[model samples]
Target chain A: MTAPSRHALVPFVSVDNMMKLVLHIGVERMMTELAAEIEADFLRWPLFDKTPRVASHSEVGVIELMPTSDGETYGFKYVNGHPSNMKKGLQTVTAFGLLADVATGYPLMLSEMTLLTALRTAATSAMAAKWLAPKGTRVMAMIGNGAQAEFQALAFKAVCGIAEVRLYDIDPAATAKCARNLAGRGLNVVSCNSAEQAMEGAQIVTTCTADKQYATILTDNMVGSGVHINAVGGDCPGKTELHRDILLRSGIFVEYPPQTRIEGEIQQLEADHPVTELWQVIAGQAEGRSDARQITLFDSVGFAIEDFSALRYVHSRLKDSGLYQNLDMIADPDDPRDLFGMLLRAGAAQAA
Target chain B: MTAPSRHALVPFVSVDNMMKLVLHIGVERMMTELAAEIEADFLRWPLFDKTPRVASHSEVGVIELMPTSDGETYGFKYVNGHPSNMKKGLQTVTAFGLLADVATGYPLMLSEMTLLTALRTAATSAMAAKWLAPKGTRVMAMIGNGAQAEFQALAFKAVCGIAEVRLYDIDPAATAKCARNLAGRGLNVVSCNSAEQAMEGAQIVTTCTADKQYATILTDNMVGSGVHINAVGGDCPGKTELHRDILLRSGIFVEYPPQTRIEGEIQQLEADHPVTELWQVIAGQAEGRSDARQITLFDSVGFAIEDFSALRYVHSRLKDSGLYQNLDMIADPDDPRDLFGMLLRAGAAQAA
Candidate 1:
């Protein structure tokens, strides 16, 4: 009991440390590990107490809190999106999250999720493709070669066994950066001039554009049968990726249906529009892909549960690697009722 | 701009350091400063984006997230309540919060609020008493002398000119502890055997009992004609402190009506029951303590805006004090699209 109490102090991995840790682990390995965690979590999805992320939207941006508990463990993430942040030399999306012991409601770990988000997004995309894409799916079309593009490309290669990636972005420099980042990764990287060119001869199509407004990066005419569409960027209300006709044609899958109705591609459809939750497919309650010619779309609006899983994975890996620092975030009073005494003792020490 | 960027990299104050800083500042002085900040925030309450807190409830307790923004600044707190936590040598409540820049949506500070909650709750009560309590009110009766008692007593002393506190609790030891904590605070502290006895000759009454159920600590007979009541403990859907009749007899002031309607003493009242927002009173748009003998109730169930104010206050105080460490929580790529490159660089550094 004493040993467990002492071990209860969970180590926190800050953004800088996380970056160093992920780099040490290698991005490809990190993505593979994250995907495995997501898959493991999705298999036990019924054990979770899940809710749609709570959002506070302003004219300029939205701030959200995403919380979930797996009976004994709890997690939450705080994230914000401001499209105009680029003008201020900041990323439009930034986040941090925590994992806690549900039995005691004590936070065990706090982590930076900006990089984790990129990794998890890519991992989730690959996870969906593993079940929905064709058996010999080796080539992926990466649309919107932004901050998350390289991660998506690597996750697919590492998790879904993809050998080639064709990239396109409205910003030519972004596509070039994506290509340069993947220089020695051993995958065939093609920087295309148009989304259509990137889509040609690809088995998987991933759209992760960061436009804040509704933009059709993929149309029904551009999409082909047997292609697994990983829709990653159209995550908030009024922000969408595929044309309506494309969504109508594809067998759309989502993380959480209620959330997907408001934030995913389904937002453009009626509430009654049929969609299969990814957890259901993972849990074997529903089929993922019916045929080789089926057009499958994973409407990948980010969910809190994924962050919870990612945080837990990072915490476990950091513990195993002995690479994290303990954050003195909780007030550990010898006597729980002696909070005031703790304050006074600190004051007395300062005075002396 | 370069200097500011460098300043942003400073280490954050650990929870221990924040406690030390707060203690060094002295509780009374800290509460005084916090009350001023709350007052200033309330004056501009109309500028904020407010929402009811998101709560996840279980049989044992609840975990909640409270978020609010003032167009330029965003803040949120993660808190939990478990009345049985004391039996396990844990606090019935624990919390931490974040302050973020609204323009870029980046978390600027993350600090433990388990201790800060005590201070802010007391300061918020005192701020309300400043507006609603009788002029030069000097005596306060504190019912339920538990974890929050001393802070409440000191805040009233510092903010509302209260010179005496009469404390009472079901447990004689709790009352004794409260008396002992306030020994050197230069106030007349009396331990009372009963709530009615504690209320005698008191100009303001504060109830902060920690029962999880609807337990009435104050009855209509015990509350005097001119006393302003600060109700703190009745902050969840089922928990309440004062009798419904006591609320009907007094003019009720609330922080965020949508929230108070569900968590405050007013939860027992009808949906149409009229209650004045405390901010309106602070703005002079509504009446506060209309007559000399009229009872006033500041139904403080705690609000997100108050947390925002407290976070802002802490950020300002800790900026130059060298009490905080900068958390590398945000991933800032030289080129926003080159996140993968940053990871690669980190990997190279680790290898070297």
Candidate 2:
């Protein structure tokens, strides 16, 4: 059999290649670079065609398709959230994304986003912390040390110059695993007994627990004044990580208002409750942190543009890193109108 | 590198494998089987989660995502339509699709839909014709001789017993290419000079021209009584093939009215114009052909459920055919909560 044409092939970055890419570029540097790409896109957020993700919810889990375009390039991510999957020895969330040229609508690249999602989520959290965290913040109380815990810790160390990450999870094994993962990483990792102990002297607190419920991982008394809360866990309709009281007192900033009102921590608040758009803040159209003692919350419900940025970043690295395999995913006929003829020829070749 | 776990591997049927599968099963037989699968799905249509395709339109083309689920399995197709892409020596439409398990939210298979879509679209059209076409329909006039023309011809022959096909295209080379490809495929292929000549003795008139504007491929005078008009190419907003007068005279049947209203030939009619759901007809809940001489038009806009049916059909064939490769697309960790640890281990293995 003859090799497929270049037009028929799409560059695919598998999980192994993605890890190689990350380790080749170094996770911290890659996160910093990914954050820069995301920040640049956020700065021009109005140009994007943004819509709340299209989600299909079942009794067991939810599957979502998040698509966005900036007129020139279009991108979408297929992601699934199944909290029970972990018990079945499957990742709670797994994702993959595609980037296509707007002109021809041909896919430019396909990448495994399970690893990339963790990296981008942490990078986004750290990017928000760069704007909303208290000035001179040196420590981050990492609550809910699950799959995203170590990435979040490293992103803080790389992006926000945090010297330490205090880890805590309801399950002690989770906390211990997180501490072990971060042992050799350039950050002070602390395994704490409780959420309260994790927050001791911390100016930034990142909540990334993976419960598909409205259970509050942080209550009113647990939060301190002048702290920035990077809320990452409450991303679905009925799932919220912070308490309603915490939301009532904090000045919240979100990725997109319509989506955040439905999926973010602000879902607990009234529909019309005033909240700032994170893009506007990144673009200097709105304030991020006003006073040193004011509570600020970056309600992060991962958006399509962030995935687009990650896709763009990975595509940029493919030329130099050589970390992708081209799969014969598209059917390209030499004569555009002779698709049937192409099939006939392939059959003839096989017969020969 | 270590072999990825079963959880991480997604079975991918590339374009070559898809062609092999198609040829191995034989095109006519595959289309007949696909028609049966589509018919079975249509019979239980209301049980599926249905939605209009999510589309992103650009100046030269449009990119669309069509997603659907049947409570147990979820599927989606990523397709692009660029009418001008042909001038650039590219296929006017390219597609790929995925099928996933709703229970675990994990992808089960990914396949190139450029060929599968052609098969399914033709299968769907033929399936609709089975219920709506005049009894013992033999000759079909395929108006547009593009990439989809031969598929439609063979599917009609296999599904509806079309023994003769009269073909015509504005570009004579396309008609010639289609005729050459369909030469040995058990049908009397007639190359016609005009649309009127193509419909001379045809019982089913299929219009599938690929102009991205309001195109009258079949005018009122061109269509006759008792004919099953399978209008295929008037998909996407502002692109219609038949004249409104012809539409007013026909008993229209559609697959998903909400989408057909915007992207089908009925886009030229009133928003509240009466149209029968083809699924209802297939399920025996609605009438298909009321009289012998009545004009019955099956307005084919293509739906997510058709693609879902195709994915399901292709997935069923995988176990027996073994015409697929496992792609390391998902990141599966031993502990599920250790996605970051998986990355760390991969990195350490690389370093060693």
Off by over 4 Å in 1: A1-10, B1-11
TM-scores of the models, in the order given: 0.95, 0.99
Candidate 2 CAPRI level:
high
Where model 2 places Cα greater than 4 Å from the true spot, the runs are: none
**lDDT of each model, Cα atoms only?**
0.85, 0.93
In model 2, pairs of residues that clash are none
Per-residue lDDT of candidate 2, residues B1-352 (tens digit): 5679999999999999999999899999999999999999998899999888999989999999999999999999999999999998888899999999999999999999999999999999999999999999999999999999999999999999999999999999999999999998799999999999999999999988899988888889988899999999939899999899999999999999999999999999999999999999988899999999999999999999999999999999999999999999999999888888888889878878
In terms of lDDT, the best-performing candidate is 2
The digit string of per-residue lDDT tens for model 1 on B64-97 reads 8899888888889988887878788887888889
lDDT of 2 by residue, A1-352 (tens): 5678889999999999998999899989998999899999999999999988999889999999999999999999999999999889998899999999999989999999999999999999999899898889999999998999899999999999999999999999999999998897778888899999999999999999888898889999998899999999937989999999999999999998889899999888889999999889998999989899889999999999999999999999999999999999999999988888889999989999
Clashes of each: 9, 0
Q: What fraction of the true Cα-Cα contacts (under 8 Å, chains A to B) does candidate 2 also have?
A: 0.88
